[model samples]
Target: MNAPVFRRVLALLGDLRLAILLLLVIAIASIAGTVIEQGQSLSFYQTNYPEDPALFGFLSWRVLLALGLDHVYRTPWYLTLLVLFGASLIACTFSRQVPALTTAQRWQYYQEPRQFTKLALSTTIPQGSLKELATALSAKGYRVWQTDNQLYARKGMVGRIGPIVVHASMILILLGGILGALTGFMAQELIPSGETFHLQHIIQAGPLARIPQHWSVKVNRFWIDYTDAGDIDQFYSDLSVLDAEGQEVKRGTIHVNQPLKYGGVTLYQADWSIAAIRFRLNNSPVLQLPMAQLDTEGKGRLWGTWLPTKPDLSEGISLIARDLQGTVLIYSPKGEFLTSLRTGMSTEINGVTLTLVELVGSTGLQIKADPGIPLFYAGFALLMAGVIMSYVSHSQVWGLQEKDLLYVGGRTNRAQLAFEQELVAIARELASQSQTAEVQA
Candidate 1:
């Protein structure tokens, strides 16, 4: 590219108007994402957002899917916006903040007394000497630098670098977000106790995501705790991570908020359900019956299983349960009430002894893996530190002495009221000390 074109590109990138416009677009897109759900199935949107009464008179599920609004952060256009925003921040930092900081660091002396009069806070002292003014400035915690009849001092120089640090931290955070959106995955599974499974059934995955195939998990146990009101207090699942050779590498009991983490993946105990029941008849070996959930048409949730009483499988009874409270209602094939039994109990029905065995429960787990969480956290820390540093108030003072007159002036970037008060106090002190010395003489 030509030099002028390069400079024009730099100027455009560093323009505050361009940065504000990008920020506005990002904000609008984020609001749209929050309002419209992301990472949902096509069927879900078709059912929720029908075409008959399209939202806003033309925005239907087909439109949403076509625009890739289902996964905004993963879409190419959204990612392009992030990249452009990051570039603007970089250009602004280099072209404006760095140069401003360099200028703030270099000292400029007021060779003529008229220059001191241009300051926001300036005064002429007829009695105080340059040395006395420097001493007073030093006593007030300024880093004094002197040359012949001119003196310069400043404090809180770190404040000049705070905006740069803030910009850097913001860039790091954006990088972390982009990385996570490009290489992370989410999955959910429901595994019965004593069953081993791998990380399959992915709900959402990024294009660059690499799913772990060598790792497996086992559900050792699952149980629930009851509250004093006979309601569910909490549910727990004992989980183990297994290697390729089926050896346990990690084990832990996970609950709702307490999750198990292993090899950069997190497993959360999300839900639970009764899978099957183990029981046996007289002179018969142990048998496991699979349980099926009945459709109550949104009235209530119930699980049922049919137990065979006769060898011909003609005569059977239905076992119905509502919750993990260990109570089950037994009914005949004709929906006639037979008996109610608890776990580890026996009841004779249709001339056969049926024993109620343990109810097998399965644990529902949600798994996630993201590689950029640490970088995001570190960027947040740096941002907070920079924000605090930005409030420190860079202050500077200059002094000049000629004949019997001394010129003094100072200024600060922030805390203007407090700086003015301090400057007034120092001038008063200088005048009072000069009067004391004259009296002693």
Candidate 2:
């Protein structure tokens, strides 16, 4: 109702404690999803957990639908956590750290006369008598400013700014990541060989939105290479370029590391599949085999009938199908006979000549487009920079001038002990310089 109440509500929502708690919960839930397997059908979960009532109940379709655990990052609650984390970082920047930075940046040298006079490292030098001390301080890279009544000095100011740069980078990165998660879309499609298709709606966006109406892509060819040991070493695809108007322009290939780009959209080589297979009866005429290829429609093209050039049927035959699902087809050369078969399944025909045995299939093409990718990447770089600056830096200084003294101190978000050591060193340097200046003056 009031601004104060609203601010307080926002502050509580953006608290680091709440963020940490949400992060932990999200992490645990993510691990559970991975362990239990996500996207599994209700029947699968039920089958796996048939004997465990608790697991069955927890993994029930109703529970998953209610909690949105099936799609964690996209789920409303998970997205809410991300929003909260971003708000917390923003609040921390404005509320707790900005003032601290201002004080540290504008830090000035100050101390009481009595405090300096009672110090173990104080010295009383004649006026205009500390030129050599100034030279030594200058050599150590301190910016020295002085009047007859007082002195002002600053050192490592640029170095001090490093932390700020790093922090700003982190905030930039966080904001970028949040923006991307909110606005970006990444989708994949598998086009079997001989099939023609265009980019459709993205199924993977955290929130479903119309895919960029301006974007679309098509896969022309896909290939894979394997080591002698049967390990995959590389994968790639040749793609036909298409505009939203369905016009063909450029055609090129892309590998796992290299992606094809067109009109601000990038198509990645995601996967492959068996497009089709060809089989002709043995003892059949060469003419009977006919032309077996994929047509523009992506369907298997076969021209000719089961009747063979040979008048007599000879021996039984084999048809081997390949791909994830190996469905085979067997037929006789001379007669009207055809039968269906699957991988690892075979039959003995009395007189069937399955001569030209062939295997075929299409490569599944995967497409993706996300305008926020660059922003997300830039944000990643900035966030890391901020974290390093916040944690690894140390800032401090001390001064002794006749009857007056000053101590200035500040530190990075990390390594307080190292910061204290640095503070002690600066103090020692000033104290030692004072003692030497008094002796010479």
Candidate 3:
């Protein structure tokens, strides 16, 4: 590109209005991502946002798919916006904020006494020496620099650096977001107790995501805690991380809100379900049957299994469990309620002894791996520090001793009232010292 065109492009990208617009668009896209279910099948959107009436008169499954709203964060356009915003911050920092800070750091000595008259706070004091003025300004926390007749003092140079730091921190945050979008992966698993598994059911994954193949996770046990009112209080899973040799490397008990982290992978206990039931029937070998959750039509979770009481399968009883608390409700072949049995309990039905062994529970875990977490933490910390530093006032004071008259003036970028008060106090101290010197003479 030509020099003029390149400069124009940079200016357009660094415009404050453009930055605000990009931020607003990103915020709206985030809200849509949160409101719409992400990483779902096409049938989900078809059923939820049907074509008949359409949502808000214009939004339907077709629009959602066309706009890539189903997965907003991973979409090409959203990622492009992030890249553009980061570029804007970089351009603005180098072209604007950095230069402003450089200018603030450079000292400007007032050559003419009339320069004091143009300042916001200026005063003329007779019989005041440059040495006395420097001493007074230094006493008020100003870094004083004096020559034969000129003096310049400043404080709070950090205020000038704060904007540059803020811009850099924002760029870091944008980079972290883009890195996460390109390299993160999320998966879910439903593993039965005592079973080991790998991350296979990938719900979402970035194109560059590196899925770990050298490790596997095993669920040693899964259980639930109940409150005094029989409500579910909490659920827990004893998990172990295994290496390639099937040796345990790490173990921990994970529950809701508390997760296990290993090798950049995190496992959270999301849900639980009934896996299988073991029992004995009529002196036969121990038989284990898989239990399936029934569709309760929003009533609650119910799992059931059928056990044959006769050798010909002509008669059987249905075993149903509502929770892992081990209360199994048995029903007759005619759908009549028979009796309830707990774990290790036995009851006779159809002249055959039915023994209830144990109910195997499965743990549902959500696994996630993101490579940008460290960058995110560092960016947030810098952002806070920059904000605090920005609040400090960068004040500058100038003084010139011309013969019998001393010209004093000051200015500040912020906290104007406080800066004015401080300058007045310094002037009063100089005047008092001059009077004390006259009396001693």
TM-score of each: 0.95, 0.68, 0.97
- CA lDDT, candidate 1, residue 291: 86
Task: Let me know the TM-score candidate 3 reaches against the reference structure.
Answer: 0.97
Provide the overall lDDT of each model, using Cα atoms, as 2-decimal numbers: 0.88, 0.54, 0.92
Which of the two, 2 or 3, has more lDDT? Answer: 3
Candidate 1 residue spans exceeding 4 A from truth: none
Let me know the TM-score candidate 1 reaches against the reference structure. 0.95
Best-fitting candidate, measured by TM-score?
Answer: 3
Error of 1 at 324 (Å): 2.1
lDDT ranking of the models: 3, 1, 2
List, residue by residue over 85-148, the lDDT tens digit for candidate 3. 8998888888799889889889889999888889999998888888988887777788988899
Q: Give a tens-digit lDDT track for model 2, residues 157-257.
A: 44444555654665565555555556556666766544456667355564433455553455565556667774557766777776667777777788776
Model with the higher TM-score, candidate 1 or 3: 3
> Which sections of candidate 3 miss by over 4 Å?
none
Highest lDDT model number: 3
* Model 3 score (lDDT): 0.92
lDDT string, candidate 1, 1-441, tens digits? 999998789889989999999989888878888899988888999998889899999889999998888888778888888889899999999999999999999997889988987789999777778898788878888899988789999998889999999998888888887888899888999898899999998987878999898989999998889898878899999998999999999999999999999888889988888888877787577788988889999997788999988989988999998777788899988999989988888888888877877888889999998877877998999999989889999999998888777788999999999999998888888888878888998
TM-score of decoy 2 = 0.68
**The 10-residue segment with the lowest total lDDT in model 3:** 278-287
Give the 10-residue window scoring lowest on summed lDDT in candidate 2: 285-294
